[model samples]
Target: MADFTGASTGGVSTIVTDHAALISACAAGEKQALKTLMKAEGGRMLGVARRMLRRSDLAEDAVQDALVLVWRRAHQFDASRGSAKGWLYTILRNRCLTMLRQEDREVATEADQIEATSQEAVLTAAFDGLETTTGLRQCLERLDGATRQAILSSYVLGHSHGEIAGRLDAPLGTIKARVRRGLLKLRECLS
Candidate 1:
């Protein structure tokens, strides 16, 4: 999806694969292999970016940028770290996180938004009237499964820290950390 015509003679080839033989062909300077890899994985990349950005247009652009990185830095794909899938996901996810952080930095939050919710009891009450909470739920799914559940119990369900700890049967400190970190992340995302 990214145009590399300005790069060089490397722009002229058509290697098509339903997967990434990119780690192989890329080292050989086969730009077409990169194209093959992108065509195969770009849709999924867009989907991930879409989930993060929640905008089709931004998702498309993010995928375009991600693909450009994939193409240009194809050599960085290391099989030992994992498959092409993991590597690609890491890059796109990082881009999405960076974008989220940038959005936070670039757009000033209203005084109300900047006001941190004071009590655990108020979280559910605050969100109860919000239709956008479903979107918030979806965004929370981006966390690891345990972290996601811990967060839902605390915020969306308004469980007290002790209650969440009891329900999860996790250490109190662990649950607290997860809740603190998860809320911070959700605030970043929902912002």
Candidate 2:
């Protein structure tokens, strides 16, 4: 079936030197340099924050704040210790670390190895904590059988639409429709 979302990711390339020129230009008070730097490194910084905070908007905000700080402090930059790219990375890292520390104060408990060691167990415990009937399972139960199965396969089993279709012996379009309908039904039920 067609994936109209146009979502595809791959071919990771790690470059430590991409931001050096932009940093140098920014340090020289070139506004164009700062703009170039933002365009060049924004995606990477966003990825870093997202991985650290597990939240998209917060990650974007963190990167934006870091870029602002970098622009304001560019004059004090020292090239002897590290490259400009490294300096930008340090700024983003510090911002994410600080945000994480502040967020830690509000959370009741930390979730360190819980995701790595016993993810299913953690999810089960969290789900069971819902004293109300609006838990994930109950909401899922309200969906059509095929749709619920498709959604469960994609979300819980971590399968793609094609994989779910293959496993369930259904057409890919059918699987995608089921998954979408299932998710909408679940959201409505929970709401």
Candidate 3:
């Protein structure tokens, strides 16, 4: 395997040439090609994953997963589309994004549970005609109809932005703004 350490010092062309050859060698199943490629690019790939995940362990796992994906999918790489380096980074990015989205779902689930519990308490108080509930109802009533509906759909019905947008026949951005503004107004009113 050729050493690519000096390629960066040599020039952009040298780096590109080396990366293309390394990718081709890996695709051809050259025994040491994948190992050589990792040696050349692993640290940079890990850095990219670390920045995306913000956790050392998760970043390491993502990089390891991305490497396995690269090895398995080497044959699918098309040099005609772009540089080999870009292709490798694309794989790493996809892995990182997948992990980030999965983490978001887990966090959202926990948050939703907490929100549900709080909402139940609020509803119970409102039904009991508590003074706080009267104040909250007045605040909610002061919001414009569209904004109020958007807020209710999100907090009460647990509808996602897209779902609320679809139900309201409004743009997703519009729904998001309405919900945000509605919450701010409610905060101001309660304060």
Among these predictions, the greatest lDDT belongs to: 3
Q: How would the candidate models be sorted by TM-score, starting from the highest?
A: 3, 1, 2
Put down candidate 3 lDDT per residue, 21-114, tens digits, no spaces. Answer: 7777877888477777788888877766755465678789988998888888889988899998899988888887777667776764565565
Relative to the true structure, candidate 2 reaches a TM of 0.47
Against the true structure, what is every candidate's RMSD?
12.6, 18.3, 16.0
Worst 10-residue lDDT window for candidate 1 reads: 105-114
**Ten-residue region with minimum lDDT total, candidate 3:** 121-130
Residue 138 lDDT in candidate 3: 84
- Residue-level lDDT for 31 in candidate 1: 78
Estimate, for each residue in 1-191, the C-alpha lDDT of model 1 and write its tens digit: 33322234467655334334665677678877767666677776776675545457767888887777776677777777677777777777777666654654334133114333332334444445446558686567667767776665443333457756875688999988987888788788878
Q: What root-mean-square deviation over C-alphas does model 3 reach?
A: 16.0
Candidate 1 segments whose C-alpha is farther than 4 A from its true place: 1-20, 104-176, 179-191
Q: How accurate locally, in lDDT, is each candidate?
A: 0.62, 0.65, 0.71
Q: State TM-scores per candidate.
A: 0.49, 0.47, 0.49
